[model samples]
Target: MITRYDSNNRYSKAVVAGGFVFLAGLTAEDCSLGIEEQTASVLKQIDDYLERAGSSKEKMVSVNIWLTSMSYAGGMNKVWESWVAPGIVPARATVESKLATPDTLIEIMVQAII
Candidate 1:
């Protein structure tokens, strides 16, 4: 059976099914932060949800990151490289896209197994 968590008016923050947890695109609570800060914040949020779902970054299988501008890639990656599990990092793709708001720098979605 499938389990959903953190449901809001727009979406469910996570859905657990078939031994996997899928996280919705997470953005920083403080949109005023820079790319590095935003990425870090987003990762931490993901971590919290993962823990709640009995999983962690080390168990992640895939990730999709959207950046408002390619110029922020370097900044975002710096924080990501440090936060990711040491070995066998999840497959990830980073793309430049127009976010919902001008101040929003990034959004990240994660998938992991229990």
Candidate 2:
């Protein structure tokens, strides 16, 4: 069975299926922030979503991060390293991509055990 939460017309923010929770790519609400702040905001959203899905960052199995520019990666990583579940780092990938908005610096998608 599949369960979804935080839905809008476009998509559900998170879905639970096959013993896993899948989170849609999320961006900071305040896009004017720099990479570090944006990254932190997105990660905080991930934590909330995971908890509502009966999971946590430590249960995350994979993460995909997109940045508007690779130059922002270092700043992004610094916040990620501090926020992520220690010793339970999930499989992750970071890449430079054009985001949906000019002010959006980063977007993050994650999958975790439920």
Candidate 3:
């Protein structure tokens, strides 16, 4: 069975199905922040969502990150490395893409075991 949380008109913020929890792409609330701060904010949000889904970062199986510019990758990585569960790093990919908003520098989506 599938269970969803934080639903809105557009989509659910997270969904649990097939023993996994999938989170929608999340961005920092304050888009004015720099890459590092935005990355940190997004990670924190991920942690909260994972916990609410009965999982944690250590249970993550995959992650997809998008940056508005590749130049911000280094800063994004620094925060990612620090936030990821040590020794249980999940499969991850980072790519440059145009985000939904001009001020948004980064977005992250994740899948974790429930």
Candidate 4:
């Protein structure tokens, strides 16, 4: 069975199935925000989704991160490292790409098992 949460006209923020959750790419609502603030917002969204899906960021198995500006990677990584679990950090891949939202600097999507 599949279940979706926090859906809107554009996308369902997260979906769960077979005891796992797949979260949509998360970006800050206010694109004008700097990388640090944007990263904070993204992490908060991830936290909320994981909680609703019976999991947590610490339980994330993998994450796909995209930064519109490659130069911002270092900044984003700093925030990511702070949120990632110390001993059980998830596998992650970070890449540079143009985001759908012009001002968005970063986007993160995650997969986790409850």
Model 1 global lDDT (CA atoms, 0 to 1): 0.95
User: Candidate 1: TM-score?
Assistant: 0.97
Clashing pairs in 1: none
Q: Please report the TM-score between candidate 2 and the true structure.
A: 0.97
State the lDDT of candidate 4 residue by residue for 1-114, as single tens digits: 999998999889999999999999999978899998899899999999999999998899999999998899888889878988889999999999999878999999999999
Tens-digit lDDT string for candidate 3 (72-96): 9999989888888789999999999
Separate clash counts for every candidate = 0, 0, 0, 0
Give the range where candidate 4 is weakest over 10 consecutive residues by summed lDDT: 76-85
TM-score to native of every candidate shown: 0.97, 0.97, 0.97, 0.94
Error of 1 at 17 (Å): 0.6
Clashing pairs in 3: none
- List candidate 3 segments past 4 Å from native: none
How close is each model in CA RMSD to the real structure?
Answer: 0.8, 0.7, 0.7, 1.1
Q: What is the C-alpha lDDT of each candidate?
A: 0.95, 0.95, 0.94, 0.92
Whole-model lDDT for model 3 versus the true structure? 0.94
Which is the winner by TM-score between candidate 1 and candidate 4?
1
Better of 1 and 3 by lDDT: 1
Question: How do the residues 1-114 of candidate 2 rate in per-residue lDDT, one tens digit apiece?
Answer: 999998999999999999999999999989999999999999999999999999999999999999999999899989998988689999999999999999999999999998
Of 2 and 4, the candidate ranking higher by lDDT: 2
State the number of backbone clashes in model 2.
0
In model 3, how large is the Cα lDDT of residue 114?
89
